[model samples]
Target chain A: MIFRALIPAFMFAILIVFFWTGLSLDPSKVPSPLIGKPVPAFELPRLSVPEQTLSSEQLQGQVSLFNVWATWCVGCRQEHDMLLAIADENLVPIYGLNYKDEREAALRWLRELGDPYAATAVDADGRVSIDWGVYGAPETFLIDRDGIVRYKHIGPLSAEDWENELRPRIQSLLDNST
Target chain B: MRVLLAALMLLPLAVVAIDQDPPMADPQLQARYEKLSNELRCLVCQNQSIADSTAPLADDLRQQVREMLIAGRSDNEILDYMVERYGDFVRYRPAFNDRTWLLWVGPFAVIAIALVIGVRVVRRGMGEVESD
Candidate 1:
């Protein structure tokens, strides 16, 4: 009888515990469905040379990083140095999706910051970005040799993130491919 | 006369600015498009539906929905496409699945528990009164 009377309190306590646990989680870190799926197909003009177009087919048979960014995105600026360092290592080819940004401004920003991307595609209308399910700029996807998106990182990429999260994943993918 | 002519000339521009260009010629299809767009949450805004959000990503989604609707895709097909791309978070009301079972059943469970407790307390009070 005593235990039966305590049931409501126990249930209420459980509810409170669930709510408390939920409060600590960041809603923005919602996992992408594209993880483990093939990267979306896109044919976009090259940022440097509009006459030349880049397609998803070109990304096959190599581990690559597809970074969605814009000159106007402050987070992209924050991640620029880390991206440059990664590019310098030549461990993996980094491609850029210039989302809904002006050609002149994108070119100028690249010139000032130094181009870290092997090939930057201009998604001027942001149509291609939609296919990639890009909600905001500065989202990075790690694509495997078979053109499958192995992992995605949202928000700015920091040195700690690269060292802890990105490098390990890249190494594993490279190891798996060979 | 000139002012009247200018107003008439600007009418089409006003329609374009308001984004009132209907996606399809059929009224039923346009209605479905509007309903689906309003039901979708803009991932960037997080708070507003795609129809209400002015975010660039929202605009892209709206355009995609329009094109898909024009292609005669069913409502469920379009929604599944969005879910495939953006996950369940993009839907304003998520489907009841393994991951979301707690969310759907939690409220009713709480209410049922409360009712049971209330009934048991009232019964105990009645027993005490009878003994007195």
Candidate 2:
């Protein structure tokens, strides 16, 4: 009886420990204040559009979303459809910075999936990505009308994020706009 | 006569090999040391390369590696010394051994054990005592 009782307790303890260790394993969860600041000034060549470039100046007048993605990335694909849905709603101008991707592959990816970006710029060498303090691809930054980045959502967005995080925040920003 | 001449030439080479140490005298040794230092993981940092880490311990380890190279230690000898002092954590790739079986096979073993125990426990507890 004691062995059986202790076995369950031991199992529970081990499970709890595993969960705690997993939680503590994420050491790169440090937050950045660059979220509420103005988008860093940069000009990058357009990925598909010829003789065209995208700049942070274009984000000044309206509330916009800057999405950092790449053709080689997987999470970007998961977020692509949601981005397209948002774009379809015409909620905000969704700008894209394709980090360290071949122009041809980026074009092909967009052709297969769908391009949700108002303007997509190619960051061929990832220099722009580094300047933006990007650790990896598929990070979304929401910029307010005054060109201040109000929110930065790392990784892929989900329905919970839409309802709990995005809607409330965007509604507030919109309310403040009027 | 030919064998004797070959032996005569080989005698000087053997003598030179014994007298001349290859570690400090070679320019390539310093370059190799620098390259290997960066490739090594900082034990404290866990995620950072020794070259990239700004930790005091990492700095000390880097300085020790440099000192070992300067002191005419062979690459293998230096690695052996570090392995002896710090164990496998000092290396980016720890070798497979009895102590590191947990590092290599712990996850798989845990999963297998869990599956076996779960199946046995569930099988013993299950019954057709269904009520409509």
Candidate 3:
């Protein structure tokens, strides 16, 4: 009789635990499928010099960062200072994927703000961005020496994010690649 | 002039159609495009399918679906293309894969558990009444 009485309490406890787990999950931070996969092949025009093209080949030889940014996205602006600071360290080359903005406005943004990227690729129609699985602006991908995407950071990256999450991943990649 | 004014401005005319591209020439292909767009979820606007979303990413995805249909790509191939890039989250109706088998089975399992519990509870109640 006493054992049967505890059943309701057990079920209630399970329900409470289930709902509590749901509360902590961030729905927007969907895990990327390309985590262990090679970076998707793409060839897009360079943002600075449109006549020239930037291809995935450039990322092949070194561990680097691929940052997707646009002139219109506020998050990209928020992360720009961190990107500039990271660029100064020269820890890894940062290649920018300038998503869907006009050439002139993007060029002006780089000029006025500061160019943190070693090369900026212009994805005008967003076809290349689709291949990269970029859902929003300010998403960053960490690529290793062989051009495999090691890590993906969604939203604007913070200093804490770099130090805590990304730097460790990059360190492991560097340690393993050698 | 008044009629022109009424037609252009005074009438409560709300044009929701913003697609500049003409409809696909092939009706069969057009149907496929429509079905696929409605099935694919817009990652930006989590609730709406790509067909219903006004987001630019949704527009680009819709264009991709239409173009793939016109290019003679199978529906499965088109879906695979999306799943490869965006993962299974792009599908509103997730596939019955190893990861999602639990999701598909979970509701039925809960019902089965409820039935067992209900039967046991009722039997126990009857036993208590008999003892009284």
Candidate 1 per-residue C-alpha lDDT over B24-77 given as tens digits, one digit per residue, 9 for 90 to 100: 788898899889989998988888898888877787788888889889899999
TM-score (0 to 1) of chain B for each candidate: 0.81, 0.51, 0.79
| Of candidates 3 and 2, the better by lDDT | 3
Arranged by lDDT with the best first, the candidates are 3, 1, 2
Tens digit of per-residue lDDT, candidate 2, span B77-126: 77666565444666676678886778889889989999999998776667
Candidate 3 docking category?
Answer: medium
lDDT of 3 by residue, B18-65 (tens): 455678898888888889989998998888899888899999999999
DockQ of 2: 0.03
> What does candidate 1's lDDT look like per residue over A83-128, in tens digits?
9999999999999999999999999999999899999999999888
Model 1 chain B: ten consecutive residues of lowest lDDT? B14-23
Q: What residue pairs are clashing in model 1?
A: none
Clashing pairs in 2: none
Considering only N, C-alpha and C atoms within 3 Å, which residue pairs clash in candidate 3? none
Q: Report the CA-based lDDT of candidate 1 relative to the real structure.
A: 0.90
- Report, to 2 decimal places, the DockQ of model 1: 0.63
A-chain TM-score, model 1: 0.92
Candidate with maximal DockQ:
3
What TM-score fits each model?
Answer: 0.86, 0.53, 0.91
Q: lDDT per model, in order?
A: 0.90, 0.75, 0.91
Question: Taking chain A by itself, what TM-score does each prediction score?
Answer: 0.92, 0.83, 0.94
